[model samples]
Structures are given as structure tokens and as C-alpha cells.
Target: MLNDIVKNLLKEVSGIAEIPANAAFNIRNNSKSEGRHSTENIDIVPKEGGSGLDIYVKPFTKNENVHIPALITQDGVSEVVYNDFHIGEGAEIEIIAGCGIHNCGCDDSVHEGIHRFFLGKNSKVVYIEKHIGEGDGSGKRIINPQTHVEAEENAYIEMDTVQLKGVDSTKRVSSAKLGPGATIVIKEKIMTHGHQTAETSFDVSLDGAGSSAKLISRSVARDFSRQLFRSKIIGNTDCYGHSECDAIIMDNGVVAAEPEIIANHVDASLVHEAAIGKIAGDQLVKLMTLGLTEKEAEAQIINGFLK
Candidate 1:
């Protein structure tokens, strides 16, 4: 039986529809099999150690986006997943995957997922993933994720990762390598509160001539929470790379922004910008003047910034 929390989480991380017959869905370590679509274009295999699930997409597959969202609703439950995807030559597709934890137990629950993508020549892919946790229990919620990407010649990839709320701690590391004429854009968003901690690091390399990379990251922290944002972009040959980081902090929270740009060749173009500060008092006051309580006004401000 699905709890209200898990159901709402699925709706946010994935979509609020019936699980497609051809979709690969998993919870904890179990994969739904009944009426599930089993297409030759994609592969979902069990890890040898019964730890998680592995996903792969074959060449020339233009199928719809796959929803592979997992949930941890019980305390004392820990989950791990390692997903591998291969987008074949000239293929274009979208992938949506995420994890949500609703803990009501006395012990901490944790989720760690590692994902890798291999993009074939001239292919394009869009990927979106989000994480969230909710509950009033004494148990803690933690999420750690790592992502690696390799783009072939002329390939293009866009990735969006989000952490909405309720995660007590998290550390994310992401890196990508691009080939000639390839391009990649990454957008990451994070929010932390109530003594939580969140850290993210990104490393992107435009290794081939004419390759390009761009990274945009935004974060918010409040109520004594801590956050670390780091981005490193490397440009080789005649490639170009750019990175930007923006953050908002409140209530004695600690926020750190570190952006690095590396140019290995004289023709390489690399640049970066970073800004971290607390929420503007005027923004909060303006919202409160619209007949909202101070708390409600703050919430609206944060939501608008994240949106």
C-alpha cells in the first residue's frame, strides 16, 4: 500500500499517472513486473549484489521518457541504486529519475545513488531528477548522489537535478566529458533548513575542439543549516566553458561558493562567477505587505527564488 507521503512524492519526482506498461519502476530493491513494458530498446538489470537497479538504452531508440523513481517511507531503511544509461548513435531521448524518502521512524534512513551516461555520436538527451524527504519523526533523512557523463562527437546533453526539501544531509558530485563539437548544460537547485547540510561539486571538461559546456547552480539555506557549492570547468584546445553559482542564506546559516575555471590551451575560453548572500529584507517585507504572515512570506520568497 502506498502512503500519502510516498504518493505525493511520486507525483513530484516522477509524474502523477499510472505506471506505464513499458516503464521500469523500482522501490527499495524490488522492481514492478506486472503489466510493465519490456522493450528491447532499453534494459533494466539487477545488480549482482542485490544492491540496486541498472538501466540501459540501446541505439536508435526514440522512446518516451522513463520514470524510475524510488522511495523510502519507513525508518531503519537504507537504499542504494547504480543506474547506467547508454544513448546510442543519432538517438534522442529523455530520462527522468529521482528518489524520495518519508521517514517516520526513530532511526536514520539514507539513500545513495550513482548514475552514469554514455552519449553516442550526434545524439541528444535530456535528463531530469529530483530528491525530497518529509516527516516529523526523530529519524534523519540523508541523500548522496554522484553522476558521470561522456558525450561523443557532435552530441548534446542537458541535465537538471533538484533537491526540494526535507533532506537532512547530502553531498553530490557530478562530472562530464565532451567530445568535438559536443555541448552540455547543467542546472542544479538545492534547498536546506533546520540544521541540515547540503554540498555539491561539479567538474566539466570540454576536451575536444569546438566543444562547449555551461553550468548554472542555485541554492538556499536557512535555520542554521550549512551549504557548500563548488563548480570546476576545464577547457582544452579551442573549447569553451562557463559556470555560475548563486545562493541565498538566512538565520545564521553557512554558505560557501567556489567556482574554478581552467584553460589548458591559449585558444580555450573559460569563465566563472559566484555570489552568496542572505535573503533581502525588502523582498520579505514586500511579500508580507501582501497580507501574508512573516513565515508565509518567507516561504513564498524562497519558492519564487527556486522557481
Candidate 2:
């Protein structure tokens, strides 16, 4: 049975209103597995001698999704977990994973998660993750996530990561290496306010011929919050790579974006773009002419920007 708080947290982070009877899932609460289920094509096995899970997707499988969500409801608790995903050859699947924290005490709560993905030849994967925090206490809510991806020949992987709001601090790190004809795309969105801090870093290597990678990030920092975005792309063969970072800063907030690209072969191509600015006055004026207040217009703009 799912408690109300856990259900709400799961919905907030993973968009799962209730546990699905026909789907594969592993629900983790307060560093322990609360519920787990597996399907014929997908197996969720506990990692031996470890506090994590090993998820395997059978070869040639398609149209499946696995949910792995973590929730923290107690204060002064901290945990670090490792999860690995093995996508077999020619499989097409989606993975939804996230973390939510609700701490109502003076002590801080933290969750550090490290996830690795291994994509076999010709496999395709869509990965989505979201992070959120909620509470009325002085305790801080912190989450740190690290992702490592290895894509085999002709594999494809798309990742969408978001940090919605209320987190006091976070550091997100991701790295990927692509094989021949493989491709990887990553999209990230984040919002931080009220003295919060967030940092993101990405490193991608296109090491095989005809491989490509794209990384794009959008973020908003408000009310004295601080944000940092850093990305590096390396093209070691005949490949293409691009990285872009865009951010909005407001009300004494600070944002910094750093990007680097390297090309080791003559046919390698790489590019990067970064922009940091506040909301445009013209946009606010246009929205306000529709009878919306300044605050409403700002909120609308920020919502759209993060979307």
C-alpha cells in the first residue's frame, strides 16, 4: 500500500498517480525498496552486495517503460544509491526516474544517486527524470545525480532532465561516449529561487565515425539564487557535436555558463552556444496588455522559458 505522502511525492516526481499493475517498476522510499515488479521482457534485479538495482531489457523488445522513483519524507536522512540499466540489442524502451524530498525538520535531507546506462547495438532509449523538494521547515533539501552512458554501434539515446522547484541545492553531472553511427541527445531544464543553488555539468565524446551528440539546457534563477552550467564535447573521429546553454536571471540572481569543444580528427565538427539574460521588458509589456499583473506576466514567461 502507498501512503498519501508517498503517493503524492511519486506523482510529483514521476507523474505516476498510482502504481500500475501492468508496468515494470521499482519504487524506493528513504533508501529502501518500497515496491518492485518486473515483466517478461524486462527484469528488475537487486544488485548483489549493493544497495541498488540492476535493470535488464531483453533484446528486440519494444514499447516498454520502467519507472524507478525515489522519495524521502524524513528529515536528517541522507543516502547514496547506484542503479544500472542494460538495454539489450535492438530494444526500444523508455525509462522514467526521479527523486522527491519532503523534510519538515531542522536537519537537512540529502539523496545522492548515480545511474549508468549501457545501450547495446541498435538499441533506442528515452530517459526522463525530474527532481523536486517541499517542506515548511528550515532544513535544506539537496539532491545530487550523476549519469554515465555508453552507446554501442548505431545506438540512440535521448535524455530529458528537469529540476522543477523548491530544492535548496543540487549538482547534476552526466557523461556519454558514442560508438560508430551512434547518437545521443540531452535536454535539461531547471529553475531555482530563494537562495537556492544548482550546478550542471556534461561531458560527451563522439569517438566513432558518423556519431553525433547534442546537448541543450535551459534554466531560470531568481531571488538571489545561483546557477552554473558547464559542458564539454569532444569529436575524436568523423563526427558532429553541439552544446547550447540558455539561462534567465532575475532579482539579484547569478548565472554562469561555460562550454568547450574539441576536435581530434580532420573531419570532426563541433560547436557551442551560451546565452544568459533576464526576461525582456517587451515580452512583459505584451503579456501585461492582456490585463495580467507584473507578477503574473513574469510567472508566465518563466514557465514558458523552462518549458
Candidate 3:
């Protein structure tokens, strides 16, 4: 009975716009309302709910500019997914995708979120994704975002992600890809506390000649929280790739970091680096001597590390 209602709602939502060609989308809901969770896969379509800012994407055309801004709100146990972004050639586009999840007065509830993108040759794309959790309670939420970028020669892509705190939350994964003569840059930052767990993964492949990829990641874990990061750079042709993951663990926290670089062709150049350690005790002591509280000094160290 509940499934019938959700199906009806989705049917109404689908009536808002036509699906793009060469695109595929899928979303599933395990449970709804105050129960398990709800998940959906939605293509970039016109606004139908009169929210004016729900989901928006402008296609790239010759000498034309495009901007996409989307805001998603989850009041309870719900999941949302976005898949397959179709970008045209020689065009420029920007996307700002954000979500706010408040799981107040709920327990054992869940949320899942995903995003994917595909780019054409000689195109430029800038993407920003932010995930935030608020309210004081013991509920669970997971966020997983994946990006598939097919940039033609001379294409450029830049991606940034930020994850903020909520009780018992997890950041499942994040990833991207790059084509030949294509350039990609990725930056990720995360913070967690209060028995939370965060995990992030990125994989970038350079398949075109002279293509380049770069990734930088920073994270902070406190209390009984934990974090894990994995970054991989693969160069299959005459390409170059570099990746780095740096993290700081504080106060009984745990962190595991893995960074890998692979070059399958003789002309390929790749580099990978990772660092996981606690805040410097001497620095903390010096800050404390400067009349800062211990907690404040710790926060300063973490902020500096991420910078």
C-alpha cells in the first residue's frame, strides 16, 4: 500500500520533464516514511514542485554559459540518488549540489545519496557537493557519491566535496574519472565526532595523451569517531596523475589511509602519497603556553592540518 503511494508520487515527479538521451538512471527505496529508508535516482529535469531551487542543470552550447544549483532536504529516513550527467561539447557548466538531513526523534533510520556526471570533449565543468547532518539524536545516515567523467581532448573538470558532522554518520565513498588530454582536480574535506564513521575513496584514470589528474584530501576525527580514505591514480597512456591524502586523528580516534598510483604505459607518469598521524604535541603545548585552552589548541592544529 505504501509502495503504491510512493510510486504515484514518483510518477508525478517524472511527468515534470523528459529524460535525456544516452543517459540511464535508477533509484530504490527499501522502506519509507518513519521506517527504514527511501532512495531515488533522478535525472536533471525541470523544477515541478514549485520549489524554484530543487534541481536545475543547464546544458552546454557554443559560446554559452550554464549554471546548476540544487538543494535537497530530508526530514526523516529517506535516500536520494542522482546519476548520469550529460554535458555537451565545447561548453562550460557549474553545479552546486547540497543536502541537509535532520534525523531528530528517529532511531535506526537511514539515508543514502549518490551523484554521477559525464562530460563531452573540450568541455569545462565545475562541481561542488556538500553534505550536512544536524539535530541531536541517535540515528544513522550514509552518503555515497560517484562521478564518471568522459572528457574529450582538452576538457577540464574540477570537483570539490565537504562533509560536516551529525551523530553516528558515515560518508561511504566518492570517485571520478578523466579522459585523454583531459584535466581533473579534486578536493575533499571531512569532519566527524561523537561515534561517527567516515570513509572516502577516489579513483581517476587518465586514458588520453597528455591528460592530467590531481586529488587532495583532508580529514579530522575526534572522540570515538573513525575515518578511512583510499585514493588511486591510474595512467594508461601518455598521461600524468598525482594524488595525496592527509589526515589527523585526535583523542582516541582512528584513521586508516591508502593511496595508490599506477602507470600502465611507458609514457605515463603517476605519483601517490598518504600521511596519517596525530597532532604534534609540541605544537599543542606551545599553543597552550600562549594562553589557549587545550581543546582550542587541538582545534587549531586540526584546522591548520586541513589547510
Task: Give Cα distance to truth, residue 55, candidate 2, Å.
Answer: 0.4
Q: What is the TM-score of each candidate against the true structure?
A: 0.90, 0.98, 0.75
The models' CA-based lDDT, in order, is 0.81, 0.94, 0.62
Ranking by TM-score: 2, 1, 3
- Indicate the worst ten consecutive residues by lDDT in candidate 1: 29-38
What tens-digit string does per-residue lDDT give for candidate 1 at 1-307?
5556666777877775445665555544123222234367777776677565566667677855666676777787776677778788987788887777888888998888888888999888998889988777899988898889999999999989999789999999999999999999999999888889999999898888999988998888888899998888888789988888888888888999888888889999988888898778898899888899989998888788889
Clashes of each: 2, 0, 2
Model 2, span 1-307: residue lDDT tens: 8899889999999999898788999999887788899999999998865478999999999999999998999899898889999999999999999999998899999999999999999999999999999988799999999999999999999999999788999999999999999999999999999999999999999998999999999999999999999999999999999899999999999999989999899999998999999999999999999999999999999988877
Report RMSD for candidate 2. Answer: 1.0
- Select the stronger candidate by TM-score from 1 and 3: 1
Best by TM-score: 2
State how far residue 172 of model 1 sits from its true place (Å): 0.4
What ranges in model 1 sit over 4 Å off?
Answer: 1-5, 24-36, 282-297
Best lDDT among the predictions, by candidate number: 2
Candidates 2 and 3 compared: the better one by TM-score is 2
Per-residue alpha-carbon lDDT of model 3 for 1-307, expressed as tens digits? 2244333323332321222233222222333211111112223342233212122223454332222212222335544444346666666765544444444555544545455556777878787766655545555555555556667778888887777566366655655566668899988888888788887777777888899998888888888898888878888899888888888887888999887888899999888888888888899999999999999998788778766
